[model samples]
Target: KYSQMPRSVGGLNAAGEWYVLRSMIPGLKDKKVLDLGCGFGWHCRYAREQGAQFVVGVDISARMLERARATTHDTAIEYRQQAIEDIDFADGSFDVVISSLALHYVAAYEVVCRKVFRCLAAGGTFVLSVEHPVFTALAAQDWYYDEQGQRLHWPVDNYQQETLRQTRFLDTDVVKYHRTVATLLNTLMDAGFRITTIAEPQPTAEVIAAYPEMKDETRRPIFLLVAAVKPV
Candidate 1:
């Protein structure tokens, strides 16, 4: 029996990624939804709860899909092991497409944007969240802390350098691509998506009170949320 990691509603990710992403989701009732990098199928289940007609959850990790399958009992939801870079759905296949904390890992975001635009039906919604440019600008991806272990400030290095960044995550060496805010929104516009909402999420006071570590997140944005739609 494989159990998922403990995640709190007020955790670092929930305060930023999930909070803003959830807010951007339009009415999903009877909608065909696609979730990219849907680890553990939390959002897939969420869409089902909101009366989505069908939900497809895609991820690169088979282990994650396995756990997601174990946790989900809905016939309306399907899980696929696929990388975001290789996502290929039929044209006009879905009503809502969402990706969270996944685009930064893909090298060519523009390619994915074009594909998304091509696949979504007219009036379809595309919502995504990525590590903020400022957060990913520094290769270190950490806050400046004093010798006494107090966080001094967050650093922004090479903000204009849109390139691959080598960093460590989950004790594993990982490579992530960095892009400026302008590039992100412009890519959507170039792909014919009308940008609807952009958010630099802030942790709520209740979240900060419960998770003191999130207090530092207020000083700088950690995640960027964007919502766009294909013109009908």
Candidate 2:
């Protein structure tokens, strides 16, 4: 797939709200970090900056990883070309595993979830940020202006789950799979991690003022964070 993932894929944000997201990470000092589906290695680079002994960025795209390596060679971040379902590390190898805007790409959720569970050390965290399922399903086919509303978004019809075709960053049309919040929880539990927290992130007022796109999502959560831990 020669898709241009939004610069957000690598940077984890187009508006630089990653620092806010990064705050959610418990701690990285002296940890072994794995940035799975690490397009362009942005998070991997940041992990090193946060004092991880080493940061490994794994991505399926060779071109994207190439650029990541070129831009981050001096930062002690390593890039590997690999799929999430088949990571090259040993079982229970990493202290922290994170994926930003990438988990949705895994069509067979169970297979990948198992991979994540097996890779984490006992009591390690699996923190990830992904598109909010509720907002996505609502917006899948309907587009209306929200000129006057109490919340960031008001659901036109809360019951319908529609399929969508949209252009990726490369401007190529792509298909996305939508799973509700309930399904997400069930999937994680089925995969063996103990779900710890599920949050629909709200952007700061400053960010909302700077980017109106976030306003459409803050109340409704266009993105959600999932934090889970592997059992001992």
Candidate 3:
């Protein structure tokens, strides 16, 4: 599991997908930032480094929080142990809310979206990334390989069906809820957020060259990113 391994912001975990997500983020200076499912608090520290007034990182895992707290030396950052769905904050409590590759584990994304809308100030940004529906629609959630160990094709099936999928990851059966791209967009709109950007980013040529295995990422998007704003 990623939690068991040392995850650096510079790591090539998702074929340099984090760089695309990080680039979309607006200035955080003097802003109060909230990070949902902030495993290991990497973004929390990032927020502080960007001169955010205060940063809060919430995750469900105690072990993850323990590692985050031990590693983080910033006084402006706070780590909380809480489920993403159970997060409660006052109205307009934060200037920005960000979630990275975390919403798929949440079955009730609509509820969380509503909460994020209420918690964010007017015109506040809500940026998030999730496993793409095309990737998650597969029950196995893996690429099919040829008999000679060459890469085959990424198979996608049952795309319209929004349900729980149990896929293996790092020898553990991880539960991820699958939702179509339409549903993902509509849910945010229903929560009264104005869509700003939708991205299916491809790896850069430099990144692809650095990691040849990531060349397949150019063929199909494995992640989806959306940035929305609460209307004033």
| Better by lDDT, candidate 3 or 2 | 3
Each candidate structure's TM-score, on Cα atoms with residue i matched to residue i, is 0.93, 0.81, 0.94
Better of 1 and 3 by lDDT: 3
Instruction: Give RMSD (Å) of candidate 2 vs. truth.
Output: 4.1
Model 1, range 104-193, lDDT digits (tens) per residue?
Answer: 998879998999898899999999999999999999999999999988999999999999999987567899999999999999999999
RMSD of 3: 1.8
Candidate 3: global Cα-lDDT?
Answer: 0.89
Which residue pairs clash in candidate 1?
none
Better of 1 and 3 by TM-score: 3
Model 3, 13-64: lDDT tens per residue? Answer: 4336767788778899999999999988888888888999999999999998
Q: Kindly provide the TM-score of model 2 when superposed on the true structure, using C-alpha atoms.
A: 0.81
lDDT of 2 by residue, 68-108 (tens): 88778655677889877677578988989988877666665
Relative to the unseen true structure, what is the C-alpha lDDT of residue 184 in candidate 1, on a scale of 0 to 100?
A: 93
Highest-scoring model, TM-score: 3
User: Stretches of candidate 3 above 4 Å error?
Assistant: 3-15
